[model samples]
Target: MELRDISRRVGIAAGVVTVLALAAPYAVLSGGSYASQLADYYASGVVGGAGIALFALLSVVVVASVERGNLDPGTLAGAAVVLGVATTLSAAAWATAIEPSPMFRDNLWLVWHARVVVALSVLIPVAAAAYARELLA
Candidate 1:
């Protein structure tokens, strides 16, 4: 897994997620952002959660797939870490930026959602950084 390969994958995944985030009808199933229909805020959060998971998975895969030649394992871990951080922040963004509806202000689960959210956030950056630095720098 050369740095370029991992970086490319990250770019693709990021691009896909970004596009989805922007192009959807935003269901708002559970927590904040809506997708198709208005789901529970918590359930709706799964959409973003999938994206976070994809980011983390990309880090993990890059690490696992291209460990021999030019790819560094640490890069993958770094990507995972960033993804985790991003996930956490994303949840906050939803609460504050994306959704932030007054209805969820009193909710408890939304706060709990932050835990996994943060984890995803941390994972992506660390993973991408791990590989991206190697690929780019």
Candidate 2:
């Protein structure tokens, strides 16, 4: 396959993974009742949950823009990168803000979940940018 095609596939895969990560707790929560609760807690808020959804949506937009071969792929990718960075910063801030709370401090699982979400936020834009580079190349 061409490098651009491969990059596109990888970008799509990354988007899928991000969506799954946002949906299921098995990846971060290790599967249990508490897993759902922690997942809900992190994903329920506007800054936390809405940010994740926006990130995932941007990831898909990057891939779709490339596939459509109409809009400027680089611009879309660049936007994703900017948004991803913003999301990461917000998530980190959110985590720090909540970390001192009794619920966050008491639950190690919540800490792990926050870290995973932040990591995924970092990855989504990276994958998008990589695909854009390959497309431009």
Candidate 3:
């Protein structure tokens, strides 16, 4: 297959994986009397939810581009770049703006989970940009 076609398929696969990752259980707290409380505290946050929504939106944009076969490569590239930038900004906000609960200090796993979420969030844009570059080439 041509580079463009290969890149498109890879992009779609990446988008699917990202969507699943966002939906999957990031970290499971267990074996502690405070685990339930920590889980509740984690679930009460909005930044993570916002980050997931933004990531989902970006994924939809990338996936939807495939349906618009008439769109030129340049246009697709531009869309991907723009959405990628927006996703990156959202991830940055999610990573820095979240205020972890004092309880989280005792549970380092939650910290790792947050870092993983931020990493995955950042990766979506990187994948989009890579796809865009390939499309342009």
Candidate 4:
């Protein structure tokens, strides 16, 4: 497997995971189910805007990283860095807040988010290293 191929796969996976995280339940309230419509809720806020931008950038990077018989190592590396930051933030939040919250004790969305963050954390470093190696080679 080439560095480009590996990075392209990771980028795609990261984008998918981000989408899943956004769709996952963020909160649950009495008399209303906010968790089910996380994206709709977050879509109107500053944080939501950032998330949207991140997803857009990631999608572009992933698509650009894997072109017709060509590879963009720099773009792949950039994507890896973005994924790394996202993973760190998500994992830290999960460990410090989500897992300890009484409301999320039985939340499947929390579990899904946690799993995706872990996957992203692992993928980011591997993709970055591969891209770096390819560049050096």
Candidate 5:
């Protein structure tokens, strides 16, 4: 396959990985009920993990449908960069803006959640950079 094709595939792969990180076991709040977990998550002032995941998922679809279909390398790279930066900011906000209530802070799960988001945030940029470098070359 061409280098452009490889870059496109890699960008999609990175985006999928980011979505998974956003959705995976952010926290298992007390009572072990899904509702309770959701409630606890939303109680935080910031957007929850699910929201971040959904946004990232939509971004991936846009990349696949719009950029990939047209084989527009420059547009694809630009989209990747914009999406990556937005995801990074949103993830960072979600991780940091979470209320420091006992419920949130007391759980080790919250720390893990932050770590996952932070990691994904980093991955987005790297993926974007890779795509941009290939397109620009």
Candidate 6:
């Protein structure tokens, strides 16, 4: 079709590829070694898994925006629902970090925090998946 369209697609693809490539290792490392992973994330030693996950998410959203940019407000509203989940996760992570309760110190709350963060994070990925399906359709 058009050169501009081709170039834009190529650029977006390149960006997605670069992000995944750079971030995948960190995610793997994080999964294998939690302390090292958290240190890396905290010290900015590498891109955090959360950041990469968000990038993957936004990538799919961009795809949807490019393809079915005219989706009804209903779908947009569905997407917005994830924002609350994200906020909750962010808040939990922050609160626990700032003032660790005895519960948090006991590893029980830590597990809960991790579970909530992960579960909350899935909301975006799932939405992004739906967006990708609609876009690719």
The most accurate candidate by lDDT is: 5
- Model 4: per-residue Cα lDDT over 45-84, one tens digit each: 3334245436434654654454543666566555555655
What C-alpha lDDT do the candidate models reach, one value each?
A: 0.47, 0.62, 0.57, 0.50, 0.64, 0.43
lDDT of 6: 0.43
lDDT of 5: 0.64
How far off is residue 111 in model 4, in Å?
5.0
The per-candidate count of clashes, in order, stands at 54, 0, 0, 0, 0, 0
Per-prediction TM-score, please? Answer: 0.37, 0.65, 0.62, 0.51, 0.70, 0.34
- Off by more than 4 A, model 4: 26-31, 34-79, 99-102, 105-112
lDDT of 6 by residue, 1-137 (tens): 54434433543453355345434334544554355534543333133445434544554455435445587634543453354244335534533443333433434434344334444444443444444344334
Put down candidate 5 lDDT per residue, 1-137, tens digits, no spaces. 87656655665676788776665553334355455554656444356666666656655665565454576667766777787777777777777766544555456675667667667666665666666776688
| Candidate 3 global Cα RMSD | 4.3
Clashing residue pairs for model 5:
none
Q: What is the descending lDDT order?
A: 5, 2, 3, 4, 1, 6
Worst 10 residues of 2 by lDDT: 94-103
Candidate 2 scores a C-alpha RMSD against the true structure in Å of 4.3
By TM-score, is 3 or 6 better?
A: 3
What tens-digit string does per-residue lDDT give for candidate 1 at 28-117? 334344322233343345445455445445544544455455755555545545654555455445434335444446444444444444
Candidate 5 residue-wise lDDT at 132: 77
Stretches of model 6 off by over 4 angstroms after superposition? 27-39, 42-49, 69-137
lDDT over C-alpha atoms for residue 59 of model 1: 42
**Using TM-score as the measure, which candidate wins?**
5
The best-first sequence of candidates by TM-score reads 5, 2, 3, 4, 1, 6
Clashing pairs in 2: none
